[model samples]
Target: MKQPNPERTPILLGQIDTDNHIATTVSLFVILLVVHRIGISVYRLYFHPLRKFPGPRYLAATELPYLYRNHLKGDWVRDMVGLHRKYGPVVRIAPNRLALDGSIGWPQVFAHRGANQDEYAKVRGFLFPGDHEAIIAAPRDVHRRQRRQLAHAFSDGALIEHEPLICHYVSLLVQQLAKRAENNELIDIVKWLNFTTFDIIGDLTFGESFHSLDNSEYHPWVLTIFETIKGSAMGRFFAAYPIVRPLVVLSMGADRIKKLQEHQIFSKEKARARMAAGAEPGRRDFMTYMLRDTRSGEKGLTTNEIEMNSPILITAGSETTATALSGFFFYLVQTPSAYDYLTKEIRSAFRNEDEINLRSTSSLQYLQGCIEETLRCYPPSAETPPRVSPGGEIDGRYVSSGTILSVYQWSTFRNPQNFRDPDSFRPERWLPTSHPLHDVRFDNDNRSAFKPFSAGTRDCIGKKLAYSEMRLIISRILFRFDYEIAESQDDWHTSQLVFVIWDKGPLKIKLKPRTMTE
Candidate 1:
């Protein structure tokens, strides 16, 4: 080895010093990061505002547990049922969120806050970003205006006017099922129910039907809606962790975004066509009532508003109704006694299928009870609709402003405190006290806790239409046929994965024509 030169030795020492300095800085940064995370965990567990609340320490310490159960597992509804059971009525589901069962929670969180207090605001992130505000995502003033404008269309009078159109689709549904019955075929009742409701809503919203009933298959637009919902459910994960939004967007790929855009464009096109066609005489479609307000020079919906609300109407009006009806049959067929009782009630109430109109079905008390019980057991919209607290009292506890709160419908409906035999389906629980079928055991059941359509100013706008469709279709189907659930689909109701709405699979059933006895 050559003897070291003085100049070279200094240069080499300087290089080594620089390398050591970099390594020291990196090590210091990592240590600080770990310490900071530990500090946060300690604060969240022992000193945070929500610390007094009861929940798993892990859930209170970080949002990861809640996210894993809800976004990753897609079984938050079932998990909520279990959470309430373990933790009591109120559960600290996340670091800053509280999930309350609906008894005191619904009225407190969703009810009017009184003239002196501000109403709890809707959670903004829940609504997907869009150019125009539909009623579902509108700010309070905008929501009030939109609700006012569309009120007439969803009113009792409008439902009466729209009855014939609804009846027409129910007839088509019966006809389609009749064909399947002739062959004694196993039908996916969920798909057929979806077809009927989508066609009905498509016609009402666009002033023309989707022809799903005529084609005996799903319309392309309807399929696009399902795809959009799945994508939206995935997008929620990003919404919860905005720091990862860019990565999530990239991962969603261009195709999904393009499909969503295409769905919006199709909705806009249909709405434009309906607007161009002006109201026809005797036409009682949803557009007719909405456009009537515009023609009368009232402050009705604008063309843009109509375009924006059309898709909301399609999804909200169709999917929910179909889900409820599907749930009704799923539970009904499993409980043979309940099924037979409902069949007798419906068939005896109407002499023939032609007589099973909306009005006729409305009077079938047991039929209504069965529908109510289905809503309780398998609500169409099972997820929590979070609201930001306005520094008010909820369930007798003072909630600070900016805290997220929700009365999760699934938890509320399944809570044993809210219903006797909560896991069991008993339509008799919904019957009037004096009614012959009424069971006194359910007399103590907290009926007020059942808000399947939700409550307050923002309750479902299409509730009347949904009930009308369910009543007519269920009554007619039961009147004309007797059905049994396919053995493979015994777990249909319990085995679903919910993504915003349910990730429903086929609900297979076999139907036979009711044998007429003189």
Candidate 2:
């Protein structure tokens, strides 16, 4: 063996200082642990902190289940209910989150603002992240200002003025259906409903519609939005982590950002032109109302500002309405008796599609019930929107601030505690005067339990308009032709692409012409 070099050994020993390496490694780990611990503590004890309350373990800790379930599974809403059933009224879901399936009331929860707008603001689909004062993204004061400005357009008089406009589309829908029946082509009710809705909304709000009704397929943006929603639902799952979002957003494709920028630009330009005219559009529409109102106010919302919010209004107003219509028609086909009954009522009520105006459609009580039952069974949006607790006692239960809470229309509507034989489709359940469904708990009361259009300040702003559109469209369709689900059954239980979900596949139906013989 060669003699050892003492100097070399000492030099090597300098490199082997474990104390410094160990300290560096340990310090890095400690820092990571501290950061992680603080984050966890915030979610668990502060952010939507419901230490004493309960829900599914995964849900309480984060929106992972709520976000993932709808996108990932068909029975998402039901699964939450299942969790509710298993865990009781309040269940701790995540490290600190809670899901409360309250029965008596949850009014204050829906209305009050929590910690900040973070409760609902987490739902970014309403508007993009921006400094602009869009109605949905604006601070409370700005939202109030914007909403007040928008009120002129959604007013009853505005609605009546627009009655002819809506009626025109209803006729156009009838004509399109006639062509389909004549061609012996099967109808994808989902496509047409959205087509009509997008068209109507576009026309009524944006001064024009894509005229999707005339197309054999959906418009590109319609397809894009549907994808965006589905994408968002999936994104929401990862968003629960909070740390993952920045990395994901940075990696987003240039095309998506470009498209969003394009849409924003288009909305801005259109709104400016409308505002510059200093007159509402000649046609009765949302922009028209907005234009008229902007004149009265000293200052106007920037074009970009209105643009940010306009899409949301059209989306929220029509997408939900259209989904409700598609689902309603889907269920009606199964319930032939109810279908026949509604057909008889509408046909007897009106002579032609032209005769079926918004005012006329409003008179049909059974129609209203049919719409309600469909909404109750297959709510437009998969969920009622989650919120953070307002930090107070609601219905005698004390909830601290930052509690992640959601009021589910899906669960509330299907709940046996609220409705009799809740799963069954029963339109008569909502008859005005006398029905077996009546009870002190919900029915015969002004703000009752069967609220498909929720209640109070947070209630749907487009309720009346949605009601008019569904009634007229469905009424005319059912009256003119009868629809039956095809050999391949239509399924409403699909992974929700958007918060406002539709069936996985088209609602394929054989539309048979209704005549005296039939």
Off-target runs (Cα >4 Å) in candidate 1 are 1-22, 243-258, 278-282, 292-298
Superposed Cα deviation of residue 151, candidate 1 (Å): 1.5
Per-candidate alpha-carbon RMSD to the true structure: 2.6, 4.6
Q: How many pairs collide in each candidate, listed in order?
A: 0, 14
Taken over the whole model, the C-alpha lDDT of each candidate is 0.83, 0.66
Q: What stretches of model 2 exceed 4 Å from their correct place? A: 1-49, 57-76, 102-106, 111-127, 137-139, 234-266, 293-297, 434-447, 494-504, 516-518
Model 2, C-alpha of 409: deviation from truth (Å): 0.8
Best by TM-score: 1
Models 1 onward score TM values of 0.93, 0.82
How much does candidate 2 score in TM-score?
0.82
lDDT of 2 by residue, 130-170 (tens): 53356644555676677777777777988888877777877
Q: What is the lDDT for 436 in model 1?
A: 92
